[model samples]
Target: PKTVLLLFASGKLVCTGAKSEEMVYESIVKIHGVLEDYDLLFKDE
Candidate 1:
């Protein structure tokens, strides 16, 4: 199943319909990592 993740420009990350904390955390970390790889993660601007 594909997890639904929402990334906002306001620095809010939303993980929806995850059955467990591990799932949510994993999704968040994975997305965060990919974004970081592309230098698209949040910045302190």
Candidate 2:
């Protein structure tokens, strides 16, 4: 099953419904990659 992500207005995130800690990390990484692919994430100079 896919994990659920709860994003807050304050820039906080909550990952839930994952089978393990590793799964949560993986999910977040995947999400980050997608955000980068779409230029949705800010890059630090």
Q: Candidate 2 lDDT, tens digit per residue, 1-45?
A: 399988776667899999999999999999888878999776456
Model 2: colliding residue pairs: none
Candidate 1 weakest ten by summed lDDT: 1-10
- Candidate 2: segments with Cα more than 4 A from true spot: 43-45
Model 1 bad stretches (over 4 Å):
none
TM-scores of the candidates in the order shown: 0.77, 0.76
lDDT of 1: 0.81
lDDT of 2 at 18: 97
Q: Please give the range of 10 consecutive residues that has the lowest summed lDDT in model 2.
A: 36-45
Candidate 2, residue 41: lDDT:
75
Candidate 1, 1-45: lDDT as tens digits: 258988777888788989888888888888878888999855596
